[model samples]
Target: MKRTRALLIAPVAVTLLAVTACSGGATDGAASGGDKAALVIAQGGLGDQSYNDLANAGFESALDATGISGNTIESDDVVGQGEQLLRRAGQSGVNLVVDLEYSHNEIIGSVAQDFPDTDWVIVNAEAEGDNVASVLFQEQEGSYLAGALAALQTSNTDDPRINEDKVIGVIGGTAGVGIDKFLVGFIQGAKDVDPDVEVLTAYSNDFGDPAKGQQLAQSMFEKGADIVYSVAGGTGAGVIQAAEEANHYAIGVDDDQDGQAPGTVLTSVLKRTDLAVETLVQDFADGAFPGGETVSFGLKEDAVGLTDFEYTKDAIPQSTLDTLDELRQGIIDGDITVWNVVTDGYPDFYSGS
Candidate 1:
């Protein structure tokens, strides 16, 4: 039974999908003479249309491309059950485990010690153990470009969505170094373009609540913010919906969400989780997994950036588009440095909270 299958597990049910391209099975383990992988879905799970789903897409692609057996593990309570799920995967002889949940960072080092033969990859945060690889993304870099573009577009009266006020906004899922990594960069970029630009900020405190997202964004809109960037995961869908309803603009995160609501979404800050997962899986299959190393993906690696503005290209001014390109190149060339909240702490411009 050499089938490439994905087992999506939830609290009450498990869904399985099968394909015939792979030559391995997850239960066979790494010592079974074939490579097998599993992706532990983060809190919001697969339908996020954002971070979790993006990583899963990469996982599936990698399995197909490398002919490795793989499975996707999900849960209704992923945050609370992360450790248990991970241990089960290791016990089942899963060769590689890519944990997408950020909360699992602190516990992964301990778990990796228990499964020395199972290679591990954790996102956003680093952990100990020689078998673990940490994948980090320079989210602030792409966010800087998003902020600059939003600042430029805020007062452009030509675009009907733009208001006369030089105001924009950002909604984060939570107030922490992880989420602020995007917020601080956006503030810096917007202020660099226009010091007086009023960049409103708020935290939804929940990544899976669209109503909360929409409420916060709508309030910002009422306060004259025509553009709002969503740093929340699944909640970002509500932000886009608010934009469309208010005839304003919303900037998406993690995935290419421009097409999600067509013209309503100005652009999306791509975190490139898909590429990261795919690359890691391929490396594992080739016995080149960068175990004991922290791999960074940023603008230089084409792992993070703004989407191509597919639906809103005609709506954006050429000068504004050109500015984004220049800023992008400047960051890549080290001529411009986007502040990293994850490492640099809160700046005076914006308190992370």
Candidate 2:
């Protein structure tokens, strides 16, 4: 399903509050005589090698460059420990806190109210507070490109590598708002590129279960889906296995998963969490934090993109690669705006068209 894009309005009151409240001296010793900044990892924890690892990469890069004394606190119960951890950071005199938890938006908002002096950064969700910075990525844009590529690859009868059925697939971890956002964009992108293309989508209902992911991908493959895109996190590892076993293609997410299965894994939709975290920390260190405001990053900002076809580049036709590049540039140039199913409703250009 394609979603419509809405015009976003800046919250003037929130901006004013951030400016007024964030006027205190630097809490970290970089400016004053204090310690370095601190960061906290969300529920999934670091070794997920997808979301958590990407964010940690940014944290590490920022710390290395700024010489900031920072540590990443990870817990199995991120949502449950949101308030407790946030309060602890505030009490520890930590200057800034960057959280990668998606479900802790409201909790962070409430906690930020109590510690108005501490700078906070949250990803994938929004939180309104005088010292909070919300970081959101343009995932739909990258997914759209992936969808377009899958659509083109599914066809092409002349290519022996092409599938007999013009069908591709998507395996989502859940049917929630976040996962749906990626699905909607993918379907829209496929349709935009080829109206007759068929997208077979399914949900594993669990992000941690790789067996379920493998089973689901197998089913999609049997149903004539030769290419499958996985937004299923750890479970997606199974998707890669299934694709390899079935001699199909699997799309990885968050990180560069192309190397996971050599030529079997097609590519990955990278959500540059590393870049986002590094930039936010740098801004905080420079005392230019855009607190109480949301920083939206998308194709225009090069914050999200498809990974290089490291293992499968030679196998894919040059024509398809050329088209993919054209579509990416079109999106960056504003000639094409991928529908954001999470923020916008179904777009008119896509619905029933």
Candidate 3:
């Protein structure tokens, strides 16, 4: 069975209790023993239109579906106060705590042991505890598709957005395996299609800084890259803005940002954090919590993939779409393997500090 725990594991750490709903009365089919839950938003917080927001949407949906009373915690110092936040939630009778901060991986294990009655979830990294459930996504797989798509579009001079240079770019929020998982996959996918394709890489080092994201992306655009992929959370907003202003193409991550800039955004690499949270809530409510194992979501589970080119579908040639479908199926069938930085460490094409 898939891993389950009373807790819903999510990425990023949160500090403050931002949104709270009344615990007045449970609606029908509410979690009998786990009525109260807490979702710890990541460092980037909401309005990211990317990672955090995507998770939040799932969280809200689950709450309504399960009729569970819940609140979301957000903090500027999510990393430093992750433990405190987890403890506070557990003490407050929060039966389930889903932490979206990757930085809380180590601290959550001890926190879970202390609050044995409370279930905990951590995303991106695993924590040891029978009550803790770890959730991971094969981000690399979806990234490969995004990379491949960008590769095909980069040199399509027929499209006004496509420049003659066979160059593309990817911007990461930070330099680590968690974020690098997306970058390396994109690089590999791009190279697989056109070994001669040039992939530029940069790090904004901040998940919430749009200015920094825009700056780095602009620099890449100046360097002959027409399509840029942003894995920088809220900071990616800046990257998208830069792409629009520069009339280049930007691939969004974690969320469907195709509408953010109708034609400017080539596509978005979606990480279905919403589905993960929803599954966790339902599992906890149904008394089917799988506490000691890791629950993973990938392309097969529809956890990660590219947007349907909602806005740019017409711009993408039918052959390119067909190729993307084949590549996606190849990974699902195990015919193609996308390098996983979390399990395999770094690859030869890129290194992190």
Candidate 4:
């Protein structure tokens, strides 16, 4: 997630009663004086055009359709303020709270216990509470498609833009279980498409540093990598820049970044944060909220996909596009099973372990 540089309000105390009421089952309706709700944006907030933006889009749509007025609260210091902000939302008489913070799962779980009457929604991570609904995206599935696309584009010498080297690369924010979930899927997809395809991998170790991202990408480019995919958050901006300067293709993550640099960005692995948020909010408004459940969205759900190769479409050959479409359909039809590094260990084909 991309963190925004915005000013935020100080945390305030919340009453326990307010929290309890919000987490409970829905009241009678407008006649019952049920409280409207609010969405607590993750640390990244808005303008990220990625996770936060998707969540906000859904929040707005849901509110407009349900006639449920709501506000989006942002916090620069979300880690220490999870309980405080959540409690405050409850105190404000908000019936439902949509939380986008990845690190606040445990905190939300803790606070949900006290506010059993209020419904809560958290994304990307799971929290245990009857009143809390967790949303997780199948990022690896989309990444697999991106890897397949990169593999196809890397070796097409007929295209002047493509280099002779059949090498692709990935820059992750860190070497953690979460980031590796993307890496493992990407590598598996590449090899699945072309068993001999070369995959160069590295981790920037910092999600916030664009400079490191640039340097890492530059190094990969020098090593004959013709295309690179970035799973690093803001650091990915640097990867896009490196591809532009080196005249190589760069794949973006989470959002549609193809327009970030016309012709330079091949595509983006889009995780639809917007859909998840909208569904949860609508459910709350309809009094059908599924508390204590983790809602999982994957390629099958249209929650993850590759962005239209807007600028690069003309550059990509028709045959390559056909191949991509085939792979996409395969994944959707259950013919292709992408790896989930977090749940499943690295496959024997990739790890050779």
TM-score of each: 0.91, 0.86, 0.93, 0.85
Q: Please name the candidate that would achieve the greatest TM-score relative to the true structure.
A: 3
Q: What lDDT does candidate 2 reach at residue 112?
A: 87
Candidates in descending lDDT order: 1, 3, 4, 2
Which ranges in model 1 have alpha carbons more than 4 Å from their true place? 1-32
lDDT of 4: 0.79
Each prediction's total of clashing residue pairs, residues at least 3 apart in sequence or on different chains, is: 1, 3, 12, 9
Over 1-353, each residue of candidate 4 has an lDDT whose tens digit, in order, gives 11223234463523111111112233334213444777777644456655667677777766665656667776655656778888877877778888887778888998888888889998878889999999988888899888888888887887766788889999987776667778888888898889888999998876556788899999999999989998877778899999999999899888788898999999999988888988998788767899999999998899998988889898888988898899888988989888886678766755410
| Candidate 1: residue pairs that collide | 29-93
**Tens-digit per-residue lDDT, 1-353, candidate 1:** 34344544444444332212334323322323567788888866678999998998898777767767877777667777777778878998988999998889988889999999999999988888899999999999999999999999996899999989999999999887878889999999999998989999999988888999999999999999999999999999999999999999999999999998999999999999999999998889778999999999999999999999999999999999999999999999999999997788888889543
lDDT of the candidates, in the order given? 0.87, 0.79, 0.87, 0.79
Candidate 2 vs candidate 4, TM-score winner? 2
Between 1 and 2, whose TM-score is larger? 1
Model 3 TM-score? 0.93
Candidate 2 per-residue C-alpha lDDT over 1-353 given as tens digits, one digit per residue, 9 for 90 to 100: 11122222223221111000112222344444454566677544556668778887787767665556666665545566667767767877788888887778898998888888889998988999989999999888899989998898888655444579998999888776677778878898899889998888898977667899899999999999999998877888899999988888899998888887898888899989999998998898777999989999888888888988888788778999999999999988889887886678756644220
Cand. 2 Cα-lDDT: 0.79
**Worst 10-residue stretch by lDDT in candidate 2?**
14-23
What local lDDT score does residue 58 receive in model 2, on the 0 to 100 scale?
A: 80
- Model 1 earns a TM-score of 0.91
